[model samples]
Target: MDTHLKMIDFDFEKLRPIGLTQVVVNSLGAMQDTTPPGSRLMRIVETQRDWFTLHDGDAEHRARIAQRLVNVLQMQDSTVTVGDWAVVTEGGADDLWIAALLAPVTQIARRANDGRRQSLASNVDTALLTMGLDDDFNPRRVERYIAMVRAGDVAPVVVLTKSDIARDAQERIAMLRERLPASVPIVAVNGMSEHARTELMPWLHQGQTLVLLGSSGAGKSTLTNTLTGAFTQDTGGVRRGDGRGMHTTTARSMHLCPQGACIIDTPGLRTWRPDADGAALAAAFDDIETLARQCQFRDCRHQGEPGCAVQQHIAPDRLMNFRKLMRDAERSEQTPLERIAIRKKWKSLHKAGAVRARDKRR
Candidate 1:
């Protein structure tokens, strides 16, 4: 058997329709040389507990990670996610096995509340940060999503869903425009309408992969259905009063849009703690960072610091949100040992304070 895979033997053309660009193919450098016998390059459309749905731009197939690849993933503390390209082989009895995965050009990820890093989607070009204009409307939450998406090197588009019902849609959009960078696109649309397909046409071009990230009842599934021109995903309404979604999208799955693009609809993220460092977090809120540079103090935290330019110029709510996100980013950057040491120090202080309180009572 040849150690080198003959490029001619593999039909790379078959994978082009499903977002296989020359750039991704070029990134395959050494991975292309290690192709197993009788293997095919496929893109993961959906990932479940122990299996994945793969597509070669022609048909979909079910596959599980090959034991060899699973062991490698375990060692790296990584799991395969949607929008990933995989090298798959057909085992006996028509069973498909993913032997290896190509490196993703971009990924949307976040640090969970438990301090674990989770990959939402990979090889994504743009992220549609869907948010409802109703009670679910939250500019700060949208900022967090933008930070997470931008940290992954993916373009962020704010999609304001439920525009038909929300009377203050324009006001909300204006607020987001003022809060977010001008470069970020914000589109308001009713996700269930055909107008949504027209409004989002720019990002729905051929060979592009887009991911929907937002809370439940934000209309991700509705947007997915509209884009695909079918009920590919189920849609549900938000709960009354609180307006929280009912988790209609249980898993992340990729659907092909009628406009020749791929859309990965993810389940609503209940708690999204961005997995970014100080620099990345700063990059997300460039406006505040720009203002911070003009402060009189070198390490001005913008919290009532003398000559703080950010405090004077930026909105109070936006500034507060940035500070909170910065704290979260710092916490997420801590190592296990560093976290343990801090916990122990805090524990000691708490114990000392309790002892003093007891002495005072006596």
Candidate 2:
């Protein structure tokens, strides 16, 4: 494929409307009937501290939206990210500054280690949860990712990589199917094959944006090269002993696919603690949730209580997993006082349990 033709796949008209809440945007909408000539709306290809590389459908160029002076929006932490729509001001000799940021229709975000929201990208249609079928294959971690993607309201597609070496892969796939919601699609493929690329084309349709997510050594970058039809991202092998992969892709970058979709490859997450509300967590465990509704108590903790439908029907391990997720969510959202009280309660229970164990021994 021609380089220029591949570039055309990054369709701005089709892509910009996604995550763009309103028809008219850029804050300038209030001031005028239509966007002015100098104020050009562009989609971000990449973002940096001072400037951004923007795409306007036809071409890509380096542009900046803010002047040297600090602005109220930036102060409010309304910063631009890759895939964000911004209105750029044209200046002499290609000088441009971002004028305003439009509201995103969908945003992929997570809680940063500091407890702040880290917005990964905007306007994405699909979140490809890439997992190596080798040692990187983990059912629990995949469930965690499903919760995160579902919370963002993005479609989650599971991609199991390294199928060439995947022994008894079908059995593992079956386990995932039983664990995940039936709505989520799963595909197993070797990352190096054209056949694998062919299988992925449905999700890589024109104007769609997909984000790659997985732990280090899960073959995300390897799959990215196949998607781009070029060696666009750097690739490396996992350790033979433990099958752990070193961080090959350290930063977030978007690549254009020949099939007309935008694929953003992200760094392997060392910590993937997601920040979500109660509804989001429940969505990931619909099987258990549906049964809980039939329980006798509204606040049915799913412990061995009378008329406990969840405890009666659900597996103990899955039920325990649900309870653990709810606990984690509470901890993440709790205030300082609430958290301290909860911590004290747990400590008291631990002390009682220790006393019981000693008594039994005696």
TM-score of each: 0.94, 0.83
In the range 178-216, model 2's lDDT, one tens digit per residue, is 777788899999999988888898988777788999999
Model 1 misplaced stretches (Cα beyond 4 Å):
1-9, 352-362
Q: What are the Cα lDDT values of the candidates? A: 0.87, 0.76
Task: List pairs with backbone clashes in candidate 2.
Answer: 19-104, 19-105, 64-97, 64-98, 65-97, 65-98
In the predicted model 1, the residue pairs found to clash are none
- Candidate 2 overall lDDT versus native: 0.76
How accurate locally is residue 286 in candidate 1, as Cα lDDT from 0 to 100? 92
Each prediction's RMSD over C-alphas, in Å, is 2.6, 5.6
